[model samples]
Target chain A: MKVLVTVKEVAEADDDFAIEGTDIAESDLEYDLNEWDDYAVEAAVQLAEAGIADEVVTVTVGRERTEETIRMALAKGADRAVRVWDEALDGAFADVASKVDLFEAVVAEEEPDLVLGGVQAADTGFGATGVALAERIGFEHAAVVNDLDVDADAGVAHVHRELEGGVEELTEVDLPAVLTVQTGLNEPRYASLRGIRQAQRKEIAAKDLSDLGLTADDVESSLTITSMYEPESESDAEMIEGDAGESADRLAEVLREKGVSA
Target chain B: MSVLVAAEHRRGALRDVSYEAITAGRELADARGADLHVAVIGGDVDGFAEDLNRDGVDAIHTVADGEEFDHNAYQAALSQLADGIDAGAVVLPNSVNGLDYAPALAEALGVPIVTDAVGMAYDDGLTVTREMYGSKVETTVDVAGDRFVLTVRGGEWPPAEGVGDAAIESVDVDVPESGARVTGFEEVGGGDVDIADADVLVSVGRGIEEEENIELIEDLADALGATLSASRPIVDNGWLPKNRQVGQSGKVVTPDVYIAVGISGAVQHVAGMKGSDTIVAINTDPNAPIFDIADYGIVGDLFDVVPELIDEFA
Candidate 1:
């Protein structure tokens, strides 16, 4: 079985994020593999190690910087890595449909038996790309999956979905499906020194829009960014000024005033 | 053109988020000078539709077909309704269930989608504001399409009031066979004490360091007569039951007083407790994002502050 996992590289903004033109300033911004996607990569690698899957392939869509993020996945035991990016894909970040379109193009090429992705990207937080990609590729899908049991022989996947209100629902889904994994599903293993060295020899393939047989117009963004601004503050926090004992006493007095304490 | 709002319901009762969606849908409809239509999909949802017949809604579309909240049934029903009414925009609560279908429904209707919308407006076109970088940065996006699907964040908009009686319209659509089926719901972390019902919450986060440290938090909770709650990490580590977990994936809570101990305030955790009347954050890091939304902040170690607070309350 071949499992394809999707990962993304997101920028961790400084406390004061500077707006550089239409986007956040790049300087002083640290980029890493999206925190959520780490679980997807971990799940894929575990399935491969357990012999439930033959190969684990990782894919991402971004510029050259994204190669480092994909390499992290490779070091973690993925068989191969693919990066899909083009100048046309720059504006696609504003909209998820175009991202879904690009992912559909990539998934068509890989032809994996199972697809896994983070429930949502740390940057966009849309939480819709995986499901949309499933629709685009004509595959059944599930989202926010915390527990998964796959029966490849029966071509079915049993999943435990984390719903609101601390409720969990167990569902059975047909195979050749997409699953958007939630966090805490498993503890992701770190790459060892030997694994890092071996990853250097592994293949990292790059594909652009033309290679996917798509042009800029075909993947035009369905959304635009008209403006950007900080959200208005409701109220500034009143910092208690004192040592721990004094501060606790002051907090108790405040709580009493608020009728929370007697 | 009309704006369609998907009403969320569990069992037979309408979820609070359904009304929140209506509130957002009403704003979009008024801005576009169009009608607002709401779709309620489930079994025996006539009562649910009536509850949705608020002042801003022009029509309430009800489909009594699915037994439970099935994602595929919702997608099929919503896509058909949106197409039938020629909806210019579709609005839903940015929830687990809503996110489940928003993408597939958008694909089915051949439209674009924007999820987790905190703010939205229409000026020649639709623009949505979304929080990124754990709410440290906000991005305003202009949806470049004639029609779009949006999942509005819960609790951002006030629930719509029922004033004008909306006409109930029964819509029939083919419910496709879903590849998945919900067997049943299993309550985790024990269901005895629901944090949502608590008036005061003493919530712990990763800063507690170890499972044994939870006793300190519990002692504080006992002294203050507050319910014991935790963030995702504590629950994931099995230090707390899933029922005591407070967050987007666990439970949304709005207690009268929320004392966040060692919580750095990630967006997901903040989404659940931001509605509290008074928020107190205790963390070692002064720059913790939890301080931004906290009504009161103590940039001291929780281990030090918590015991002091417990002693004071005692």
Candidate 2:
């Protein structure tokens, strides 16, 4: 079985994420593969490790800087990498870049047996791209999927979706499907130094929309970021000075004053 | 302007969130002076359609056949339904399934999707309010177009009331051949509690220190007959299962009473439980964000306060 995994370049999860006025300052932050995307890569790699997949292809949408992410994916064990490089892409749709349209364009061309991506991009956190892509492709889609098993011979995959009330529903579908891997889907493997060197020798395909017979007119951005600003701080902590028993009493008094407990 | 709300169900039993989404859609329709229409899709959803009509829905479009809850299939059918009815806006409940189709549905109609939406108002255009950045802040999103998709946050709105003579209409939306198929679903077992339905919840956070100390919180939960829950940190640390995580990343709950111990509330954590009737916060830091929305706050260590609270409740 062959699988296609989608990756995104996002602010590293460890970034300070300072919301200054309305703008999120990405200037001081380091860039890396999105945390959730790592799970998608790992899930695909696991399929190979389990001898369930014959090939795993990692796909990313970005310009030259994003190649580093693709290389990292290779280090994590993807057989190959495909980067759709558009220098004019500005990460916004209307004038520059749009996440949904760009992803839809990529999926339409790849047409893989299975597609996987992180549930949401950490930076924008729109959490809609994978679902949107699935819709555009008219593939069966499930989000927040923590577990997946595919029947290679039968060309069908069963996905375990996390739902409210601790209830899970199993949806079995054919291949050429889209599933968004959530955090905790799998423990992502680290890219060893040896793996990084091997990635340099691996093939990474570069493509454009025109080559894929797709057009920019196929995408549009509905929401606009009017301004980015930092949120005003709204909390103040008061230390209760005492040992366990005394502090408990004082806490009780506060709760009572606030009408929390009689 | 006509409001379009999507109905979600498994087999034939409708999800409670559908009622909430319709309530939210009803609000938008009320503000826009339009009728509210619900689109019910599944293999067999007649019962769901009947339930939806009880909410005073102006019309119901029941699209049956195929595996009922597939997102890709739902999006295509919804897009067709939205176009056929000329809906001003489409609304969805922000569940895993809802998030899957909202953006795609919006894109298919060439509109923007306002996700995690909590409230809506219509003026010259439709205005939506949503929380961003883990609920550390609230922002209002206004879309200028007539057709858009909106996914309402869970537990944000009350379910729609059954008050009108709204009749159910059977609308056949040709089921497109699904590119993906559901083969199976398995449930993860923790069995400690069902957080969404709990009347009272005792949630722990990073401040609790070690996993062993969780027993203390559980003791308190038992005393009050409340469910035990935790922030994403606890679940990430393996102190609890993923289902117990309460934040934008996990389940959202609106219990009647919520007691948070050792939890320095992050915006994401608060976004999940801010709807609780009464919030009592027990944290060492007096200035923890949990105290901001907390009705009763105890500025004390959970190790000290939890035992006493448990004993007192006993």
| Candidate number with greatest lDDT | 1
Candidate number with greatest TM-score = 1
Across residues A60-167, which tens digit of lDDT does each residue of candidate 1 receive?
888887787788899999999988888877655546667787788888888998999999887667899889888889889989998888888998889988887777
Q: Give Cα distance to truth, residue A24, candidate 1, Å.
A: 3.0
Interface RMSD of each: 2.9, 5.7
User: B1-314 in candidate 1: lDDT tens per residue?
Assistant: 89999988776678888999999999999999999999999877787877888888899889988667898889888888887889989999888888788998888888889899888778789888888766766788887766989999888899999665788988887987888878887767666798999999999999999999999999988988889999998887777878888887788899999999999898779878999999999888666789889999888888888888888778
Q: Name model 1 segments beyond 4 Å from true.
A: A91-94, A242-249, A252-262, B191-200, B207-227, B237-239, B252-257, B274-278, B284-289, B301-314
The C-alpha TM-scores of every prediction are 0.91, 0.77
> Deviation in angstroms for B139 in model 1?
2.0
Question: Candidate 1: what lDDT?
Answer: 0.85
Fnat, model by model in order, equals 0.69, 0.36
Clashing pairs in 1: A224-B142
Report every candidate's CA lDDT.
0.85, 0.74
Give lDDT tens digits, candidate 2, residues B1-314: 58899988765578788999988888888878888889888756776776787555898887776645777668777888888878878999888778867777886786777777766677878767665544444555656577778888777788887755675777766656665556555555446666888777889998889989889888887776678899876886678887687876577889877888888786568878989887878877654568888776777767767887666656
